[model samples]
Target: MTEAAARRAPTRAPEQDPGARGGVRRSSVRGQVLDALRAALVDGDLAPGEVYSAPALGERFGVSATPVREAMQQLALEGAVEVVPNRGFRVARRGARELGELAEVRALIEVPVMLRLARSVPAGRWEALRPLAEATVAAAAAGDRARYADADRAFHRALLGLSGNGQLVQVADDLHRRSQWPLVTGPVHARRADLVADAAEHTALLDALVVGDLGVVQSLVREHFAGS
Candidate 1:
């Protein structure tokens, strides 16, 4: 095992919910642990391809191994991690090809929906989402990866929500998270300049949306995933 793998240990306790009932409280804590572990994976704190036992992860989060196992199972379903027989779990390693495929999938679902929204929704509607878009840029400028991820998800979700299709938003959100997953090699948003440039793309996308420019919007959508 690598030094990184060796250090995976329960370092803290999971926070408990005081208001909920027995099962609800357990479920709530499990969800919280799941979210924390997911964030740690995205933040590159839990090294990809490094196997970590559920007990160790549970220890780190100050939670029971059961919740950690449940969280890891969810991560496995998301393709963020995989199970190891008689061992534990390791963050799945994805390459450029997988990312490209996800980009293609996202473009197929999002582009047409976005184009339709440009025609149907008023300029003011898109303009109203300007703050959400700007928030992403601000997050990127500050080199806040977690903030950027949240803002990015919010901005895209809001934009896609303009289509008034809940299912579409859910699917797009799943693909978006996969696209943002940290590579086994490292986190993509480590460099400030790259994030700044990507942030500018958000501003440009908003411009196209506000003007209801289908051509520009389509082009920007394709270009947006080019580097991602």
Candidate 2:
């Protein structure tokens, strides 16, 4: 892998919120707005069950409502936001049961694929991903909510990308983003320690991949989701 690729953060480009920049293409602007909104949702800037208009978000990001609306439409598809009939959109509120189900689906998809990758791929390939994983841990430790969210997404995306299935990586990345959206209730239950612990799982997961023990990999995958 290229050194720059190895040093890349866990989150994919489309998932990054780089703020507004001038002279960008319309399509790219929409993506940036979407990423910004998703980061807001994960960072608790967009509270659950609260309606936010495109124009308001536009003001926040210094863009027009058109792109903001376009971005929100994508988020609506991800179940991260729901469009109001007359209003704009409200953040989707997922309860404990829904969270559990989401976690189950993630495990169902990621575990087997990861296990297969562990068996087929060389340990060095997985080892090359350690820098991205370490970036995630640093983000978690720093307590920058948005950065941590992006790094966490990047780490998992990179991990799953090792399986060499673009479609699987796409789906798993979507699920990961959905899982990170803040709940309707005020304040996130996952504190700094929780984030630190979650970030630490990347190392353990990488170690398991290097060890290539089916049983160990299986246990870690299951326990990781259970803890989530």
Candidate 3:
């Protein structure tokens, strides 16, 4: 665990608005835009503390300011970005205390949730996660920023059933986007040997969860943050 990552607090939960939120059924234009942007943030294409404008984004998405503003509001509520008074929004700043608090809250939410998910954290699911996990490792090795970031998050998402709490997973998504985790595992450090260690830890968690080893799983989970 790096001293830097270990010190981040939980004040700024970053955005996880990626992929499609409302599905492709065309529920609302704003919702879809929000989903795409959130996914971008989670994927690290949109780094923490990056500033962007709603109008420009709306134009880029072939929409208007209304949906863009609405989507930004939803993201703000999720703690991904902050809406400046006159300025649009900027990715929340990262700090030790902020990340620590985020980690603490996530632990509170996920530990019990995962405890409950113990029954459902099956081998079949582990098998499914294998490919994602392997991809993450490969990304780390190859220094593929985009692939690593997306694959890393996907591996976590692949376990949505393990936590058995959709809300818990959402909470994690919200926190990680803003967390210094990007700095730790982000592409800037994609080729770092330490990141490979982090990938191994993720695999360890999967193994522990698969075997229903709560003690080890929870311990590793906490250490993941502590070591970060």
Order of the predicted models by TM-score, top scorer first? 1, 2, 3
Candidate 3 Cα deviation (angstroms), residue 135: 3.7
| Residue pairs that clash (backbone atoms under 3 angstroms), model 2 | 10-154, 10-155, 11-154
Residue-by-residue lDDT tens digits, candidate 2, 1-228: 222222321222332255646535667767777767776776677888899999887776777788889889989998998999878999888888888888999999998888788789998888899888898889878765677878888888888887778999999988877788773343444577777888888888888788787788888888888876
Clashing pairs in 1: 10-59, 10-60, 11-60, 12-62, 13-62, 14-62
lDDT of each: 0.79, 0.77, 0.64
What TM-score would each prediction reach against the true structure? 0.86, 0.83, 0.63
Pick out the ten consecutive residues of candidate 3 with the lowest summed lDDT.
5-14
**Local accuracy of candidate 1 as per-residue lDDT tens digits, 1-228:** 223323333344434566655667677767877777766775577776789998887777777889899889998998888999878998878778888899899888988887788788898988998898889889788776656777888999999998888999999999998887873343544566677888888889899988888888888888887777
- Candidate 1 C-alpha error for residue 143, in Å: 1.6
Native-vs-model 3 lDDT?
Answer: 0.64
Q: Is candidate 1 or candidate 2 better by TM-score?
A: 1
Using TM-score as the yardstick, the better of models 2 and 3 is 2
Pick by lDDT: 2 or 3, better one = 2
